[model samples]
Target chain A: MSERINSAWSPSSREKERAQARKRISRKQAVVAAVSSIIVIGSLLTIVVTSPGWAVVKKTFFDINYGREVFPTVISGLWINLQLTFIGGACIGVIALGLALMRTTKSPALTPFRFLATAYVDIFRGAPLILIILLVGFGVPALRLHGISSNVIFLGTVAVVLTYSAYVAEVIRSGILSIHPSQRAAARSLGLTSGQTMRYVVLPQAIRRVVPPLLNDFVSLLKDTGLVSILGVTDAVRAAQINASRTFNYTPYVVAAILFLLITIPMTRYTDRAIRQRTNAQNAEGAI
Target chain B: MSYVLELSHIRKSFGNELVLNDLSLSVQEHTATVLIGASGSGKSTLLRCINLLESIDDGQIFLDGVEISDPLINVDEVRRKLGMVFQSFNLFPHKTVLENITLAPIKVQLKSKEEAVDAAMTLLKRFDLADKADQYPDRLSGGQQQRVAIIRSLAINPRLLLLDEITSALDPVLVNEVLSIVRDLKSDGMTMVLATHEMGFATQVADEVCFLESGNILERGTAQEVLHNPKNLKTQDFLKRVHQAGRL
Candidate 1:
């Protein structure tokens, strides 16, 4: 009986033939992929290099000396962009969480605050970010409010934080609502007060669920910080504009583009990886 | 005898739909009362009402003869004496099993973290779940999650435990692990009122069984009388269906 089972389980002639066929197909696929990549890339390269516009395009956007000349200016401007995004992102974190919590609160006393939060989100999320940056950047200083700096960087960061908070608040509110109501019941039934339940049970789960989307908003916020250039904030885009006009070459803009890509690409990858990890964790739980 | 928990003329409705009509029930100390009914029969609603998760439209609930349904009474204080296990086993997904169990103990009961952990460890060890202490709920099986949920409630040492369809969410094989935990709780003389679909397990553990139909108790008696020889036709028909379904 053991010998019979062993032979039955072992690779038969048909199984060997199938395995050999699979190997052959995979090898063919590898060769096909390599050939296709070469053909597609070679043709694109040939078209670009042989095109009539190639020389002007290279001279305008890809000049190595122009890139070198603009590198310091664009990189320095990126430092400002980094500072704006980080500071604005941090402020958005606190402001958005507060708004989300206020909007979600069941307290009747908070009704006006909830209305205000809703109004802010509706208005800001609907309006353009550029318009918001322009208005806050220029408008706040025109008001000449006491203790409020007229500095473009500070005003630009405020505008970015304001607009992004509306979006981030909605993201967090959705995450909180996505949690099952039964979780609240479980917590309350354990004698935890509503505040304790929100603090200990609900918010932690809600925050973890929203991490990916929050990171997405942060990446967008980082890119949108470039809009501060319109306010004369001297961010990467503004620096690129200045250098491009100075040398009459678009290479500076390309340099700035590369700098933005360098940061946004890594963040995008991290978000994808985090989302995959969450999905895998959920799948693993379901499997067991 | 004064009951551990008592409901008088309990009434609850959601929107325009009345879920529970004028219902009244009393649960004795150290006794298990199993509520059996079909879906949408108000079994879960009744449990939720008793736990104060749902406010009664009109009624009075008394825990240890103290009126709790009154608006003037502090609901949180009333809830402390009651432990509830939900059908979905809503363990805090972010917390480890031990953290899930210890949260209410430390937060609500004001026990030291070490004390809560000690108490939680004892319950976990008793349930053969000590190994899962550091694992999150998602890492555990449905049965294990449900067990951890039950342990979380038990950790508070509640005066009365309300279980709402606790085993209804488990697979056939996983049901026994949860049911046996209830059985152990019964043997330990824990005062529990449970709404369940497990008629067989209900018959085994219940001192008294109540059959709820359309927000009213169609039948109520000793488990033997209700489960084995129910007097009402509705109760008999329900049991016949249960038996046919091989659930009884």
Candidate 2:
């Protein structure tokens, strides 16, 4: 009887035929997908190459020599954008966390601060990023405030931090509010102080839930750093602008765009994968 | 003997709906006091009030003869001496079983990390859950999670344990495994107050049984007195319904 049970559990000859049929279907699906993708992309490429103005467009935008000549300068300018992103990102994280906590706190002592935090988020999040950058870049130095550096980079970074902090704070606040009240109840009942509960139980879970959104904000922040080029910070976009105007060729602009995509595409893929993994983890039985 | 826990004229309400109204009870140390009632009869609220999870609208709660209901009393201090288990098994999903058990000990009780982990391991091993120590709460079956919750409560060596319909959310087959741990705690003379629908288990464990109806304890006596022979009409009616449901 045991031997018969073992045989029953093992794959049968019929099962092998079913498996082969499934493999055949999957292989057919892959071939169809590849053929359709090629047909669509190939047609689009043909249309572009056969356009009436294709010669002028290619000469201006796709000049390999011009692209390579501006590569070093564009790459150097990207270093400035990278610096602003890391420094501005760190500042935004700390300030946003404080704002989120202030908004979420139920303490009567923090009531006025909560009101202030809400007003801050409303003002910054509502105003346009470029407007904020322009105002801060040109306006702050006009104040003639002591100990304030009127450096365009400093002003641009400050403006980015202010606006992004508001947006990121809202994302974090939503994550915090998404946690069930029962979790707080459980922690509090276990004798954890309200502050301890927030620090130990709520924040860890909230931060984890918002990582994908946070990464999306990071990508936006990186792109928005280019807007600071208007303040003459010599970032990638500004460097490309200088080169493009000098030669009357758009190859440098294309080069800068490609460089930006090189960084962002990998980041976007990582964010997508993170979101998929989180969804799968949530749906899987016995997942942690 | 002085009671381990005493409540007098406890009143609570949510909006216009009064959940517990002038309810009063006392629990002797090392005794299991089982509260049997219909849904929305204030059994869970009563336990919550004792644990200081809910503030009483009126009246007083005395834990070890101290007036914990006083406005100036530190609630966290009161909660440290009491353990509570919820019906939903409110285990922290982010923490491992061992971390769940040790969190309050290390953070609230100020025990060293090694000391708390050692104590948590002892409780886990005794409860037959040592292997699951590193597993998150979601990875465990309902029975295992509830057992770990019980162990978490026990790790603090609470003066009184409040169980609010703990097995109500469990599957019928899994309910016995969770109840058996409570039975073990009972035999070991842990002072306990439990709200449960399991009358048979109540009969085995309860030193005293209280039948609550509409936010009032309508009758109180031994399990046989309350279950087999009730004096109050409401008690008899509720038990008859429980009997018809095959739960008594």
Candidate 3:
């Protein structure tokens, strides 16, 4: 109490933190400025190119304004990519949680179960994913093991789900172990059943700590979904490639690149903010 | 006299090293007994065995005239009747003070949440932490949190309350707060068994004080007899060191 009184400065002498915070430009203005800078830099290049009569340089991004003919296909392609990512990422998350629990359970009787899950992870993560896609897409029907038929898109979906869940499992295992043993003890001491303690006490804190890392995994899973298009899934990336090949125009590749950015850019920004906020919390705790 | 709890010839060994060897004591109903000893003297372990927090390899523990250490005894039922507070003030960090107090009553006892909260509120108010009802354990002072832990145990309305060095973790200034709450508990006719190094707490609140060395109860009697004129040389030496430490 005495220390606080001594540390306090005169009202007029203190700097206004809010006023200082207000001095930085807003995010909207920063984006506006960046876009304008790109335009200015492009026009400078165009001016230099046309003056020199360089044929290849003459069609700078500024001089060549390809009309809005490509807009509809590009927009649809981005929408398809977004939908694919959400579906694939959700499947990976749901499967990863079960596998992570399998990896950590200690019962010797459940050893077979644990080994099977581990083998699944090791095989998918170790092999080339492209081969796994072809094997699932082609081999299943040829084997005639059951009534299953050849479904390329279904097989592609299965391949992506299998590949990403292993990495997600590791992410989840770290989350569960990060909780203090005392937290679980406290729950057990209250006479809560083992499962009840896990569900109510342990998982809540562990899941909170893992959210940012899980978000990172989810975003990565979304990006990996584009690989599925190679297995004839007709996803955004595949559609763009088909159009590009047919017309022999480079526009489709550019369109696909934009499609990727549309999904990845916002996802990256959200996870970045969430992770930074958590990191800053850790730093504050260290300061204390 | 009908005793609330009796541990006879209790022997516990963790591998080769014996933590408690033939330790025995009887606790009377509504009486406060304090166990005093140096570090690693098995005083805490002996107290923990009564509540079955730690199992005893040999010997018998009887609670309320019923043998509790028997193979047929249901430990969960025994634990419901026994409440323990730790030196570390093991308040659930994620829970509020009131919720920590109310959790076991609702969860284990199957009492309605409203009924449990009412019982918890009384303990919180008695501990002068009613205002801290919604505050997390980490937000409270060490003394306040320890008191909350004590109140949390008390809310369960245990027939026997075991306090294992409850005030040792508190600051010097905060020690008195916890001790006074313990003293108040005794005055209110609560039956409690405590393990403490503070000779003065033993003198002020305990009806019987036991001097422990290694795993044996070296001496036990009325607080006045043990505190003022102990017969054992070890007891005298232990109290002398306690006094010197307090002075320092």
Candidate 4:
């Protein structure tokens, strides 16, 4: 019986030919893409090298000796950026989770909290991150509140966490809302309390669904950590600026940029790979 | 003198649409009560109200003489004594069949994992689902998934089980398998209130049948009386349509 089923299930000659045709077309497209990218990059490089402005641009930006001389200060400054990203990212995760749950709760007693959460998300998401950093970092200190630290790094971290938490909260709330209502019904029908249902059943699935997008947010937040230099915390960009102004060379800026890319590129690539895997899993489930 | 489950003048509505209106019902202990109605006749809503999944606009529901539908009543406490199965078999997709069965037993009932797993395995083996216990709901056929859903509800050892169109979403070939599970539950003296469209299965398992029309019980009698000798014109008309469709 198994042999008969397998024999009848094999693809016909026409179907096999169609499959081969599709493979051939895809292979031809790959070759075209590869050739086009090489030609475009090669011609652009050649033009830049042969251009009249090439010598001055290279001396200002690509001077290897200047880059080496500024590397120590910029690397030290980059440590501050990493600290801000990691610490602020952790604080944002906690605050964002609370805000997301508040915004998504159906209880009438929580209406005020939900309203506040919604307002915070709307205002912060609508405002620019830099504007928020400037306002919080500068304006809070201007208030002269008792015992409040006016330190640039502390203020800057607080600003970044506040701004990013709003965006992350919105992402998490969307993930929670995307879950089918039937899942909640099923959980509640089984005698689980609403809190228990959310904690054990709803949240695990919601967090899994939002992981790729949440990682995407972290990548952006890591880059935004550079904006803290505006508050005079002497992070990578600030260090690069001091070096470039004193030496009349742009090499330190390139060094700082390379350092940022070193972290963000790998993270962005992982997020993309996660997204692809999620899509493939969904497609496989749909086919079944 | 107290019925096992009773609804008194229950009223429920969604927005401006009245789904159930002044509905009252009672089920004796260890008896199955099957609700028969057309698509929008409020059978599912009535069952949902009984399980406290839907809040009644005005009414009282009694379980063993206690008023469970009062606003001050803790719904979670009431739900623990009642089990419900849905039309689409809303088994947790992330959980295996055994895990699904054991989740409520362990989490809400506070049974030890070992005890829950043992009970779950016994039930799975009885249902011929022991081989599929480790498989997810998506990996099972619709019939198997529905059986697992029933088993999941039973794991709670509920006083009453509410089945809402449990066989409606299944294919005709698979419907018999799910219906047979209900039949076995009936024989085991499980108290159940089921909303179903299966007239033949209803006749076989139900001690009493209630024919609902526009959210009111138009007729109530033994299963044979309602299915074969319905008096109300609406019930007769509904049965005629079902018979002509060859479903009865």
Number of the predicted model whose lDDT against the real structure is largest: 2
Which clashing pairs does model 3 show?
none
For model 2, residues B1-248, the per-residue Cα lDDT tens digits are 89999999988998899999888999999999999999999999899888887888999999999999998999999899999998888888888999999999999999999999999999999889999999999889899999999999998899999998999988999999999999999999999999999999999999999998888899999999999999999999999999999997
Off by over 4 Å in 3: A1-75, A101-135, A139-151, A247-251, A279-288, B14-16, B47-50, B65-74
Candidate 2 stretches with Cα past 4 Å from truth are A1-10, A285-288
Candidate 2 docking classification:
medium
| Chain A fold similarity by TM-score, each prediction | 0.90, 0.94, 0.75, 0.89
- Candidate 4 residue-wise lDDT, B64-160, digit = tens: 8999988899898889999999998988877789989998889999999999999999999888889999998888889999999999999999999
Candidate 2 deviation (Cα RMSD): 2.6
In terms of TM-score, which candidate is stronger, 1 or 3? 1
Between candidates 1 and 3, the lDDT winner: 1
User: Over the stretch A115-187, how does candidate 2's per-residue lDDT look in tens digits?
Assistant: 9999999999999999999999999999999999999999999999999999999999999998888788888
Chain A of candidate 4 compared with the true chain A, TM-score: 0.89
Which candidate comes out best when scored by TM-score? 2
Q: Report interface Cα RMSD per prediction.
A: 1.1, 1.4, 2.5, 1.0
Sorted on lDDT, best first, the list reads 2, 4, 1, 3
The C-alpha stretches of model 4 lying farther than 4 A from their native spots are: A1-27, A42-52, A107-112, A141-148, A283-288
A172 in model 1: Cα distance from truth in Å? 1.0
Per-residue lDDT of candidate 1, residues A1-288 (tens digit): 134455447888999999999999999999999999999999999999999999999999999998998899899999999998888888999999999998899888889999999999999899999999999988889998899999888889999999999999999999889787888888999888888888888898889888998999989998999998998888899999998888789999999999999999999999999999987876775532
